[model samples]
Target: MTSRALVVLFKELREALRDKRALSLLALFVVMYPAIIGFTLNRIIDKAGSPEREGIQLTVVGSEYAPTLMAQLKQKNVIVTPHAPLDEQATTDLLRTAKTVAVLKIDAKFVENYAAMRPARVELWYDSAIDNGRKIDEVENVLREYTSRIAQARLLAHGVSPVTLVPVTVQKYDTGTSASRSAMIIGAMLGSFFIPAFIFCLSTAVDTTAGERERRSLEVLMAQPVSPAQLVFGKLGAATVLSAVGLTLELVIAHAILKWLPLEEIGLSWRLTTADLTFAILASLPLCLFAAAFEIALAMNAKSFKEAQSTLSFAILVPMLPLILIPMLDLQTATWMYAVPVLSNMTLLRELSKGADIGLLHYTLTAAGSLVVALLCYAFAAVRMKSEKYVLAV
Candidate 1:
């Protein structure tokens, strides 16, 4: 808080700004992550909206033998293409291109078997690796319906009730709303957006602590009138500022992309208003502080910049644990979840996206949880810097 601390703060900021690699990395992540998230969601929308607009691309061999089946497929929105008989290898190659959903191969004995009231075989050929599973499933559904209809007609012709074959009928209904479903999917990604908070501050945190010591100048700075707490606070402020600004810009760009995307087509939503988004970014600043403070605490122990960077590299994975694990574990949102650092931010953002009514308690916990931990880390770094052993080593 002293003028000397302010001087130290401005001085560190200037040095960080001069580091071209750090600035470039900051810019790269600011743009790169949002673009990737948008691209992924856009692809999901396209895939989800495909059936009604594009229909299935099915290649049929020996189509003349089954006119009724071809008509039925057309009615079900299948684009049937007549083709010559293909060997197994040819079918495999065709499926590999992803041009066709599947090849419908009518058995040579189909007509003979049908005329004799026997079961006729029809094979659906497709590559299991292809991403068009929905299209293949559609084709199979139509085949099942066609078979059912033939059996029904045969039963009627023989003076038997068709309803006798179907003892029970099952129907499906989805209870989950689109917003709820999308929250889970988007929640996993929200943590990744904030990871840059730690990354953006790494260079400054390492350079200010371990790097200064390695350059034999940290002792000179400590010789000044500034208290150890003030010195750590100044350096912490510099790193936190850089991290917060980069993370804010990254979130802004991501917000624009997510709002611009048609997430509804994929049963997803990003319904964050400008006010909600502003609050989310503001609430996330303490997380940046936590990241910078955590980095500084670790970097303080390292003997050199390289050592600090390598050590902090492993520390980066720590924040990622909750982000990766919680979603996989399908942990329910508890009040206690709002008190866990990175997970709290994700839960808060997810609720905001879903337009949930967040109380002041959740917001307070989200900000306070990280801020408290940040202060603890700051206290540790300050105490470590003031220790006799560290001074003797320097």
Candidate 2:
């Protein structure tokens, strides 16, 4: 940028600094997002580290009829609380109280059915919407094992081999490492870190271009000796500077929180070093630049602040779609992934956190892609400003 552009940059930045409301919103998001991410991971650690899962508390009716089954559940760390017979509505009501994970009702004729060699039904009632899936699964496993053992014993008494019921057994294996598994959980949220790159710059970008035009000050500003390039660069620079700083601070705070967290409790890891984090912050500057330039390109064209804000609000979602949808698609990470804007930054950070041995090529592609897009947007805005029709209209 020329010296003229530098003056314009400082002028806009000074004006922005005086806007306390915009600054406050920026500050709030900078701290708020990292704190939220930290709190979520901490909760996960607490849940995973708890032993016995608080004994998978179970409410059982007719417990006396299946003492052996109760013993089996207890052995598997299920705390059995005996209760009177509950009808369907009562059982549903009890489950809704969240006092226990599930209600197990042993059939009243269990003893009679067992003696007659007939099937005995055991009801396991649980609320599927509740967040006790693991406990429910444990209860079901124990019941299955208990039933299988009884069947095996009955077969032995009839002089039939227990193996006769089995045709073949298949063994399964999981190839996913701890890093990949951890990524599966954290990757869902990784996009949020880069999203601020777009958001923090929105106010400054929109206010400077469209706002000035709405106030009817733009024509006078355009009448100045400064070239159109200088004006465009200056405004774009101010927004980019704020966005870059905000994004960098957010990344550092998030990194500290993730590093402090006991993610290992849930088989997760934050494998990023301070040096790696620094590299990521530096590499992500282009995303901030891209965000500012993209908004400025659109906001410069709009006639008023509200028009700019409304149009940019919808237009911005076009770029962010990749950030929200790519993880859901679960596509394998490839070379081309580094060529996208928001996605590239997130992918780079996620890969780094997984301790992936990143090369310069990845960082180059990540930064270079954003830089190219940013330059294109910048060029377009400059061209728009320099247009003969635009000056005449103003």
Candidate 3:
């Protein structure tokens, strides 16, 4: 029986390797995805590190009334170069260059309004879309700080205590590990990568099984000396192994790409420790099994490859819905959340990556639950295989 199942596994693997379509899909998942992610991270780092302090210039384009503002900027260690009063076009041109990140456009009647104690507005012309919103934030912080300091000085001159300006200060206390916070965000992104990979596996599983049955090969296999259960297990086992390989490759790629990326600098400490990696690999077993079994069962119900693909695709995507919605909800992973399958793995991935110790009971329960579900699905698939109508319809 073992030899027969081994032979079946070998046959399926060989076929997958020989099939150009299957190989191409696997290559896309393994190679192209990593390349895109690596290049994107590299670009982000380069852009963020480009604006070094030495000789970095912010073009100040305005009339000659804001000498104090220039002095303030100079005192803050930023090199400010005074340019001739700029029109809209000139300001736009300055913003396009690497040297000039921004242009401080002073209103025409700035000094008179300040002397009269009236409201004054400063226009900062710059690109808000640069370097993942960092440049814009930097400019806004500088402007706000400068404005507040000036206002405080003015208030002091009028014998007013600046203490009244600040009504209250709120201090934040975080109970979470700094590493966990960073790992959680990166883990969310990693979860998205699995979605597409799982979709491929689900689609492929159904195509390999039910599609083969509809093509009349299943009867030929059943006519052999192997039991129906053995045949199904062989097919499911092959898919589970392949899915594991795909997942391993994705993790290796993620590790390599993240090596050069400055995740630590950005307060993201998303390194997968040894225990975390082991847990991730072990935890994924139930997920893959359940997904494989469900796809196989759906395929058993399907009359053709097209129908199976459509059915499995929709179901496989159900796991990804939470991944898409997780960012919007802004909720941290709670203990109860570990009961959910995909979300559980996602949360565990985050916790593990951040070096958090996960309880063995939780991991065991989740894995067992997933396995139970997969077994039930397998039973359903077996029942469908027994149905003469199903076999005859295909």
Candidates in order have lDDT scores of 0.89, 0.87, 0.72
Model 1, 175-227: lDDT tens per residue?
A: 87777777778877888888788898988999899888877788898898989
Of candidate 3, the 10-residue stretch with the lowest lDDT total is 48-57
TM-score per candidate, chains pooled:
0.92, 0.89, 0.83
lDDT of 1 at 56: 89
Looking at model 2, the pairs that clash are none
Pull out the clashing pairs in model 3. none
Question: What would the per-residue lDDT of candidate 2 be over residues 1-394, giving only the tens digit for each residue?
Answer: 4988998999999989999987987898898889998999898777665436577889999999999999999999999999999999999999999999999998999999989999998899999988888788889999999999999999999999999999898899988777777776887778788887888888899888888777767678788889999999999999999999899889989988888888877888877789999999988999999999999999878766788999888866856687667856868889998999988888898888777889999999999999999999999999988875554534
CA shift at 245, candidate 3, in angstroms? 1.0
- Candidate 1: list runs displaced more than 4 Å: 51-55, 96-98, 158-172, 388-393
User: What would the per-residue lDDT of candidate 3 be over residues 84-180, giving only the tens digit for each residue?
Assistant: 8888987777677755767877887888888887877678777765542565565566778978988898989999999988899889988876577
lDDT of 2: 0.87
- For candidate 2, the clash count comes to 0
